[model samples]
Target: MRRDILEHYKSTGTYTYAGPYSEYFKSLPDDIRQLGNLICSQVIHRVTLREGNSGANSDLRYGDMTRFPWYRLRCEDDVLMTAAAMTAELFRLDDRGFTFQRATENKIVVT
Candidate 1:
């Protein structure tokens, strides 16, 4: 799964979240971290499958998801977005100080 995820990013030129959230991510339980990675992989795969089935050209723009090959979940921006959302939901489930916020258009603040 990790290899596939790396290959997907390489082939698509999509960014992955490797920023300041590293510490927080590392602090997560092994199972949670694995699940997050898996979710991220699935998100990319599903989007690619949808685009391929839609018969549209794949778009590799920085932040466009309307056309084919959109970077909905294949870029750092989307990854952070998903992380923020997931953290918020998971925090509600278990108040574990795993907080993420979109500090800017392309930046994520994790705590």
Candidate 2:
């Protein structure tokens, strides 16, 4: 990862820019989609950096572990991390002069 990108994230509280993660983010259409893409990529990146590999489908703690049903149900931290990332992304957008409001029924997520 580039030092500048890290610094930018630390300072801005968002990867909502879609530049550094162009391969994934640019094609994602919205901040929420981009963030989800970013998080998935980070999981692979972080696991490889720490374990010297992506841990494939074996390690329950990182890598392609999310592919497992039990892993998704049991890994509690993932839920928190995702919520936090979404909040941060939204907050950063608000800070960037975007305003939000309550609306009618909407799909919060897709399965």
Candidate 3:
């Protein structure tokens, strides 16, 4: 995903999170941190499928899904986002959607 973002940026000379994904980048540290945030946001906003590695495929054979809700996240690149925020964002993108009430209700766990 990181490579994909870099290649996309190299080709388009434009960023992914300069618009819709900005809020997710807002919490990132300043300086070089924003670059990481930008790259991550772009990948997450662009890629699809959050499944972990499966024995059926070599690429899916490695990776930890317990610590990361790979199945819940729509984008494999979202691992870089705050766990809480990413979870919330995923929930927001879910069929049920999100609401301020749900956000405050601890439905989203950050750690």
lDDT of 1 by residue, 1-111 (tens): 699888876452123453444577666657867656533322223344435434342442222234323332344334445444544444444454432321112222222
Residue 83 local lDDT, model 1: 47
User: In the order shown, what is each candidate's alpha-carbon RMSD?
Assistant: 12.5, 14.9, 11.6
Alpha-carbon local distance difference test for all models: 0.39, 0.36, 0.38
Error of 1 at 36 (Å): 7.3
Query: Which candidate wins on TM-score?
Result: 1
Regarding TM-score, does 1 or 3 come out ahead? 1
Which one wins by lDDT: 1 or 2?
1
lDDT of 3 at 89: 53
Tell me the spans in candidate 1 whose CA falls farther than 4 Å from its real position: 1-21, 29-81, 97-111
Model 3's TM-score against the true structure: 0.23
For model 3 the local lDDT of residue 81 reads 54
lDDT of 2 by residue, 1-111 (tens): 999988876553333433333353335446777555544433333333334324453453333333323322322334424444543443343442122221101101111
- Rate residue 46 of model 2 by lDDT: 30
How badly does each model clash, as a count of residue pairs?
A: 0, 0, 3
